[model samples]
Target: MIARAASALLVASWLVVGPTPAAQAAPATATCTSSVGPGIPPPAGLAAGVPGFHAQWYGQSGYPTLCPGERSTATVAYYNSGSRGWVNGRMGEVAYLGTWGPEPGQDQVTPLGGDGTNGSPATGWPRYNRIAIQPAPYVGPSQVAWFQFTIQAPVQAGSYRLYLRPLVEGATWLEDFGVFWLVTVLNADGTPPSPPAPPVLGTGYGFQNVATARGTFGVHLVKERLADVTVKTLTANTTECLNNCPAKPLAQYAAETNAYAGMNGTYLCPPDYAACAGKVNSYDYAVYNSTLRRWLNYNALNGQNGLLAFNGTTTSVYRRSFVYFQQQTPVTAAITNYPLLLQNGAVISSEAEQSASQLAKGTKGAIGVDGTYVYLVIATNANVTDLAYVMQALGARDGLNLDGGGTAAMWIGGSYKVGPGRLLPNAIVLTKP
Candidate 1:
């Protein structure tokens, strides 16, 4: 009965209601970015490999900031290495996708919006004994399979994980190939996004609307006037870089640090290099957090400039000298990477490595300072050069290019001003003291 009910709801949700709301539409100038990447391995508890099944989770697609109790579709794809193909069986005796962990080793799930009883969650799948989504991929032995899931963030506000793994209904569980992401669901109730705390200085650092050349982009802006507001680099673990794995979802870092907003930080070591910075987990890029008072990692300039937080107060953009000269006074935060974008109000060439800039050309993330207001900008349909002009137009005294393309995104004002479509290496974030 629950399975039937879930199927009915799935049918209703699949039908086109009306025109895609403006909010649902990708920005006009947005570029195509694959939300799919190597799926991070299942949380520590998963076994090494499935004997008969081999599944590689590509990644998933969704806005980073999800509103509580809101229903949206997250698209995830995986490569199938099993002997049999996935099929939708009448009694659900075929291969299908199942949940990974509310705990490890549990290859079961209640359909979204359903209680634990009823039929298999995979029964909600639209096809019969098959798997695919629009712009379908060839799915079979060693081929790629894509699945679209309509998920709802729990009513409560927090970062939550909705894991997916493949299984053969009534037959046997497949290997523990996992695909999941940490979603930061904000509490807006039924109303517009609301800030967690009252605004500081009448306009605290959060999401603020900003007009751009193409359209209005909400920038995650931190007010220099507000005291106790801090900006830090966000990655998996706070204050340290981990080796050999991809960066965690932004929500994980934010929830851990209790940050108000998160945006992609500087580019990391070249993708082709075996080590990110000469070691798997150790960072090769230069970064420092003033509030944390730690030198996370350091490397020489790669023809790159930096965004620096000095004395735990002021922020500045400088050349390679900070590293060579060695400061007497304590420096709070220093981030160095890539080609400088804007220096002294003039646009410069991009320093992004070739690997990161190939296909994606959509909305990009950047940082610029205009007096006391430090801005995190997402330029719609712009490249690094275009981002520099954007900062100059915003009247920035100096600006630094952050990792853009798919790595681009901003979360503020209780919503994703510009949502990151991919998991990133690091981010610059704001927090309340």
Candidate 2:
């Protein structure tokens, strides 16, 4: 037997789209071919021969309009009405909001929400709060799960993304497939925010390195520079753009062209100075291609291969994305530029860079910085190489790992990329306008 229900309002809207052939209201309940909902058994048949299925809703607590805090939760139940084989699968995704576009401090990002470990746990069952995947109690397969640390609400709001999937378990406790959920939540002020005016899509391909003091940030599109990247503003003069000037800065470069090095020329900085110093450099999260090389796992941390970075409601670095910045004026602030990588303080220099040791460990993931925003990437497959590739493809100059394995998820650009997490987390959001 199959059952279904429309959220009432959605049904009403569907009726208004156009006159139905019969004009009769659509059925409120439809026969579900497979198990789908909060803690329920898989139907007679599904993609695989797993059983158990279910779904639920979660709401965030009091959060301000300019800056929001949010939370999410769901329940799962399994029964012995199906197959005798134990189930191993992943969960679905929940919708959330974020911003994107071209504006000063304007965030043009693909954000990943914030969720983390619930509490302390030494062994056996996975710790609470962090993202993970495990057998659904009495179900047919494993489901993705997550536990939010805080409620997150954004200042500007708009449709966002969410994705979820179920995976088949392997010999070593790893999953193979799962669902992807996409959802969008409203802003605190009631309505969603508008996307920023579109940027003049540039045709010529080139790199830009923008710098600024303090909290100021901006992106410059360069052309004909040797290093492939040059610093310039998209709108204002260099003088006025004391920090992020778009126009005049071009002329200033011309007058003092001799003072600056050739575009292709490399500039040297103290070796100890972090990864992004002295040069307008960037990191690319190249996709993982296992055909040629083998990915190494973390051998020192008791078989744990990677770390996590949380960005839910409570933490100061919550819900951010990666990008570059230049100040409007010269200012002094404690700034440390490096690839936003994270680790549990374990050194893995022989295999990777020392930065790898900085990844968030024990519980969740890590966070990376670009200008004023934060770029976050969570993992579903604990493969660190896979995580690095995804980040690079997403345009991260210096990437870091957020919670992964079962704890990876992202809610941005009106979409969601959830992997095996049971609970959802807040996100580093981006506004449109």
* Best-matching candidate per lDDT: 1
Once superposed on the true structure, which residue ranges of model 2 sit more than 4 Å away at CA?
1-382, 389-394, 413-415, 424-427, 431-433
TM-score quality measure for candidate 1: 0.46
92-144 in candidate 1: lDDT tens per residue? 33445665442212444433322224342232343322222322322444444
Query: TM-scores of all models?
Result: 0.46, 0.22
The 10-residue segment with the lowest total lDDT in model 2: 261-270
After superposition, which runs of candidate 1 have C-alpha atoms over 4 Å from their true positions?
1-228, 234-242, 245-247, 269-283, 300-305, 321-329, 351-360, 413-416, 420-425
**True lDDT of residue 101, candidate 2:** 21
| True-vs-predicted CA distance for residue 76, candidate 1, Å | 21
The lDDT of model 2 is: 0.24
**Poorest lDDT segment (10 consecutive residues) of candidate 1:** 1-10
